[model samples]
Target: MPDPSQKRPVIALTGATGYIGRNVMESLIDDYDIIALSRNGDAKDNEEHVEWRSCDFFSFQDALKGLRGADYAVYLIHSMLPSAKLTQGTFEDMDVILAQHFARAAAENGIKQIVYLSGIIPPHEHRDELSRHLQSRLEVETILGSHGVPVTTLRAGLIVGPDGSSFPILAKLVRRLPAMILPSWTRTKTHTIALPDVIHAFQQVVGREDVYSRAIDIGGPDVMSYQELLQRTADIMGKKRRFIPFPFPTVKLSRLWVTLVTQEPKEMSYPLIESLAHPMVAEARQTVPGISDGKITYEEAAAAALDEEQKKQEEKKREQEEEGSKTPSPVRKLKQAVKSDVRSVQRITLPEGQDAIWAGDEYLHWLSRLASPLLHIKTTRTGVQQVYVLWWKKPLLELTFDVGMSQSDHAIYRITGGRLLHAKRAHNGRLTFLQIPNSRECIVAIHDYMPSLPWVMYKYTQAKIHLWVMKAFGKYLRRWKHRSTTDTKAAPRQAMSQHDSTVR
Candidate 1:
């Protein structure tokens, strides 16, 4: 037990970069002196009161260095990476070995408590290969308990959050698809907890003195079927989805299907699909004191996940814009003085005769080509040219570009409204539509890729790449306009609709 008179306890955290681990880190930021451990070294050089250490979890000696001088150590590491060489047949064996290693290390370091976030398994359930993941989790719980260092294990089901492996994929699939072919397991009941709620549970365990060496099940207010979850998510997304549950056995096929749809690695999806095959609803009526009462409802948890996903998409779009603006185009450089002057000088002109007929045509053409691979571009005939200009209040350069190969096949592009536009792509490849304000001159900026190669080695190579294509197209169009000698009029522009900008 931590002495009340002592200063904040030094707590070591494993899996600091993981989804659940990140939430725990944020919750403990001001409360404990965190010693964060990850295979990748400390992300930043300086974290106030947080000591960042790098460790290879597979190596006992390496992991021990991070556990030193820690009162409580959170062991959140799991072997979910698809590329790991461990056989699926021996997952439980590997988990036992790892847990023993961690337990020994914590005991040697004189750590007071071993806090672990584990999966919940209902008592009396049939234990099979599908339930192996939970069994392994339970094995770790026992291993930690044997070490004499009290362990507090918080068992939870699917963690609902933007970054969570299962929920984000589920939410995106529900939002994007109008119909789904669900497995037989869709009828199986499961429990869920919001990422925030899971973090709160950990905080409670960390702060409580009487809570050691216990395995507690934590869940949100509802225990619903997989089909019900899908329906609720669909309702929130404002989409009607048809879920057809075939009588076919789905362990193998469903795993493959999830892998394709979510683009999550096979290793991660396999265990999850197997777990879902069994009903994962909580059986125990007892709850952790103080922590369980504050649990959120399924609807609220779903809403939080959706909100976080939307925010993540917006942030990714901003990052892409910033990256795009930094790499200057050769043509942009030539017109830099004029371009800078144009921002301070705004004017609208209308073309005469047939020339005016194609005023919106060129902007639409540029927009279509620019967002082509990324968005299903379209235009409206209402003589409206909606432009959105976002200037950085700071000195940072902004740029955006599609990171995937093949424009038409890219996940970032999608259709919205009657016009062609560049929709935002979250860092995780979730697509979102941008609401643009109406303006005569809207700068649709994109980031160009800057290679890490030597400047001389790749400067011209970079110039000849995608940017060259855009530059050449722009130049040819300008020449065509000059030769035609037609006067074109700018169309009326409108600001972004308030309704469009707000998420319901």
Candidate 2:
């Protein structure tokens, strides 16, 4: 055992239980003390240098506490899976909210550097043309660096691991199907990286200052087509399979079949399948030095992944047998509950020189105007904002400003008590207006909100209306931004014309 008196740098790592995060933490366990952030806020038994902290990325306070004593941080979060039972936003929007909070918290806590795992972004003049999954990754990379923290971004293509989402899906498909129907996308060239190599790359760059704020592409020695990857996996498994080439690329149909065959959630598979058309090979200019040596080949990676997966299956079987007589844990029961909380997020362009406080104030007033005939909004002397529908006895929704947590660039409003909210269970529910520091983008988000109505009723009525209203408000903000710019430009011309008249 290492000396307890010796000091080691504490690295605060998000997604600590995820596949890549678990591997990365294990790789660096000997050299660094790690603050592992989990939603459940629990640590494993007998972890020598690891401290577990419960962190909800949706809450800035939680993120701030999680990174409090860390010298550096690692961000490996992806929002493809739903956080709550009822999530009413796109995965991209959800990812943005989480990134904004984490970035701000990291900056506030004086973290020196952040190492982020991201997906490779193909060369595109218009970022809108990129797949949704890759686009979110790129956005996250930008946000992590926006808070004045040096972020080392390692972008990888398909990571071949023992039991992750992407590689396991591929392996399952190969093993289950006797004959594979190959689409045109199967010919797209992409790179692959072994899990061990990825962990090695992280170990090299996490504390290094030279590669700070740089995006590095990590991959295996071989850049092969997707069809070749499938074939290599088949060869490793010693399975005879026939591939029939279909000339057309229909990603929508392909994603469905892939999900069905692999038994993976569509949330995970769809974005990946959508990205198969893009060539994801790494750029030579973005490669890291010295770390490229001794990279594993695809064949070697496939064999090792298969062996490891088999071992994991055996272990899982033994554990299941042991736990057969035991009851489910409370956390498991909570996850299985039908009525879950709600999270909604939307990004809006902030007008020039406006802050989050202005946005939050504008939203309250604007909402009243938008629903003028139906709803009435009022604010009390205590700064509690309430929304009432047609002078009903009770307010539909009530928002109390959290002054202690609110800042110039960030505003927090707790969903205190309301007729439309499940007040008893809405302990953490809040509405936040977040202005990204040094940028014109802002996020309006609702987190952990539970509705008073039944789940199905709320899903159809309140959820749909909320989304529609947010979209309209987003458009309204953009129009305000455009009008603000126009008015500013017109003011200069108006002054010049008056000066010319006076001179004449």
TM-score of each: 0.61, 0.89
- Model 1 lDDT tens row, 236-295: 888889998888767788888777877766656777777787666654564776665437
- Model 1: lDDT equals 0.59
List where candidate 1 sits over 4 angstroms from the true fold. Answer: 1-5, 82-93, 325-504
Which runs of model 2 end up more than 4 angstroms from their true locations? 1-6, 43-46, 325-339, 436-439, 481-504
Q: Candidate 2, residues 1-504: lDDT per residue as tens digits?
A: 234577888899888888888898899898899999988766454378888888989898898888999999999888887778887767987888788888989999999999998877786536888889888888888888888999999888888888777788899999999998899999999898888988899888977889999998888888988899889888889999999999999889999999898867678899989988888888888887755332898888878988999997798778878988545543465467534788888888887877786777778878998999799787775667889999697999999877667767887889998898887773689999887656888888899888889989989999999989988988988888433333322332333455557768
lDDT of each: 0.59, 0.83
